[model samples]
Target: MKRFVLLVLLVALGGGGYYAYRQQHSAGQEARASAVAQPRAVPVEVANVELMTVAEEVEALGTLAADEMVVIAPEIAGRVIELGFKEGESVKKGQELVKLDTAILSAELKQAQADLGLARDTHERLRSLVSRGSGTQVSLDEAIAKLASSEARVELAKAKLAQSTIVAPFNGVVGLRSVGVGDFVAVGKPLITLTNIDPIKIDFRVPEIFLSRLKVGQPVSMRVDAVPDRTFTGQTYAIDPVVDINGRAIRLRAAIPNADLTLKPGLFARLAITVDQRLNAIVIPEMAVVPDGMGKMVYVVDGGKAKRIPVELGKRLPGKVEVLSGLTPKMQIITAGQMRLRDGSAIAIKDKPLRTSQL
Candidate 1:
């Protein structure tokens, strides 16, 4: 009776375990089947690529420099007697910038003038005496020598006086003052830096590949990060004859008009130089094109599926880019759903494109 009871208990426990396992397995299979039947949520959008002409431009970082930068220095040693211009002052050509002590020079000039007058009188007298044969030839010759010596002294004195006053060489803005009133200055000492700021220069370089397309007098647009919201317009002024051996780039310079003095010297700038103008080029939104490992590609929606098509990219513009090849005038492209798409993946166009109003 004990054995019989044990056997019955064992059978009951085994049967109950088997039934639970079967129920759990059946529930898992149903859940998996339901999940498989449900559709995946995919976000999608559409774009149309149209052929339009786009201008090609090259970009580079550059610096704004003065057209002419000169360091003003004293030519002769003297004590500063007067400060004609202050720091950061604009001066015109030949304007007096600083006055050095000229008291000694002035006295020397007065002496020279007196000597010159005396010599002139003596020379006149000698000439008259020589013509009349009242004076010896030797005496007349001595008088002539004295007159020439006096004239030379006068010239030397005038040169000295001129050197005492420092003048501006050209029209420009002066930098900080290096010497003050009563300060002694030496020859070759820098007084200040003078810079011609009107119509400044922007120096930039372009890749050698653009050598054929680039030309002198091409229009360039410049922007400086130092001053926000301001763009300086300019044109290509010059191009180097030879390419840079190290960088393999061609140096180019542009002249920018700084009428309001908004652009300053030594400020960093970014330049956009239009090298070529395409009359009729295919343009599409930059985001519409996707970059694959091999090359740049874009998906064209045809027969409700994404068709992976490779493209040749050209000049890039703000928010839009130009396609050199692999597109037509009117073709629907997948723009927004690229992240979730692969080759030949099915796509559903969500909403119609927003129409742009023509002016």
Candidate 2:
């Protein structure tokens, strides 16, 4: 009875061991086959980078300057007696600006008038005497000379009196006053400054390459740093005939209308001039390009691989760039995931298409 029980237990143990070993072997084979059948996940993306040819544009930065600026100065020296206008006041041409003390000039004018009256009487007497042969020719001639000299002195005194007052030469805005009442100023000293704001001039510079594009009356759009939202329109008034040899640039002057006096001289501004226009050109997002040390290039995707292609770049606009060469409209390019890729790298396509806004 004991031997029978031991034999049954042995049989059961052997059967259990065989069953466990077969199960383990089957699982191993199944795992190997599954590993071979399943595809590896290669985190990747797809981009349809197209080739394009775009227009060429040039950009430049410049400053704004006055079209006409001048300083007010006294031609004759005298004490300032009256200020005709306040500082920063707008004055018209020939408007009175300053008045000088003319007390000495007034007295001199009075003395000349008395002298002229006496000379006139003497001249009349001499003429009558000469006609009657009672006066010598030499005496009549002396009297005539004295009368002419006295009249000249009277005119000279009146001219001096007129010089005592200063007037504006043109219509402009007056600047600060350098002198006040009772201040003595010398000749050629600056009394004030004035600037013509109407039809203001804006001066800027452009590269010499745009020399041919610049015309005498080309329109220009300008914006001031102080007033970004406001854009002033003007036309090119003049171009410097000579180019700056040191900077390789051409100076440009444009006339801007500042009727409201909003634009002031010496205020910095940004200027833009459109050289040319294009009807249709190849344009791409800026991210599609990868700049190399020597040149620029982009990765073209084909047959689940990345192919590096070099390209010639042209004008770069906001968010879009112009491709001069090495691309076509139908070609696909890798815009995203470029950093993780290299030349001839295997790639997998993503489900979603790339959008222009994505870049």
Candidate 3:
């Protein structure tokens, strides 16, 4: 009975092994059949990588600033007695903008002058008396010192009286008046804003890596959202010698011509400067780039297959991007249908690819 049971187990194991082998053979045959089927080609538009001249630029957000800007303030506290200039009016250098009441100051100055005159007379009398042996030398010396002190007081009073009037520091336009006639203002209080806006200055910053390419008199172009249709051109007139420690960027200043007086102070501007130009730069259409995680890539149609290649990008131009590496001139890259492409995928060009000469 034991021998019969062993034989039955052996037969069952052999049958199970044969069934497993048959199933494995069938799965292998299906895989081969699937491999024989062709994948559908992705229809795409292609652009050729062209070697051309590209302006290597540094792009940065900039601010439009007056060539010289300041808030006109009074040096001494007083009530506004006169407004020498009107709001929004062009002011010349040394033109008076506001006049504070000088009644008390004038009175003080007159009193000082009177005291100085009295002291001088007294000193003269004392000196004459001393010469005539009537006043002591000490008395005469005291009178002379009093006269000198009085003169100094008069000069101080004159200086204080001059502070009552505020004048334009430069040729600029005056902002709105902050104080009116009879309005009391304190020292250092903002009375109005003075901005010299004819030739405006644009303040911007660029990464420190571009330091070597920056210099005075480099041509740059500026665009502002307020005047979208116009483009203002200027030259970089100054560069900060030191780089900002926190941002690793260097500051720059450009002189923008505002002869027509269209650009105003405090307008937000976009600045682009061509630091260098590459005659052999590999340029591709901006649509050809595929953002992959933190980097960018492109699909090059190589030998009728989609080949994914990572690219290092440089300056961006209108409708195009500079390719620093991972591509060469005359290479065909899928631009339109790259969204449906993968590495080694089949690609069919919807039309003839763009020629390098035409790009």
Q: In model 1, which range of ten residues has the least summed lDDT?
A: 350-359
On the 0 to 100 scale, the lDDT of residue 321 in model 2 is 78
Clashing pairs in 2: 49-333, 51-328, 53-282
Model 2 misplacement above 4 A:
1-58, 275-359
Listing every candidate in turn, what is its Cα RMSD in Å to the true structure after a full C-alpha superposition? 13.2, 9.5, 17.0
Q: How many clashes does the backbone of model 1 have?
A: 1
Q: Compose the digit string of candidate 1's lDDT tens values, residues 35-58.
A: 788544334677777667676678
Better of 1 and 2 by lDDT: 1
- Number of the top-ranking candidate, with lDDT as the measure: 3
C-alpha displacement of 208 in model 1, angstroms? Answer: 2.2
TM-score of 1: 0.66
Clashes of each: 1, 3, 0
Instruction: Write down the TM-score of every candidate.
Output: 0.66, 0.59, 0.61
What are the runs in model 3 whose C-alpha is more than 4 Å off? 1-56, 129-134, 277-359
- How do all the candidates rank in terms of TM-score, highest first? 1, 3, 2
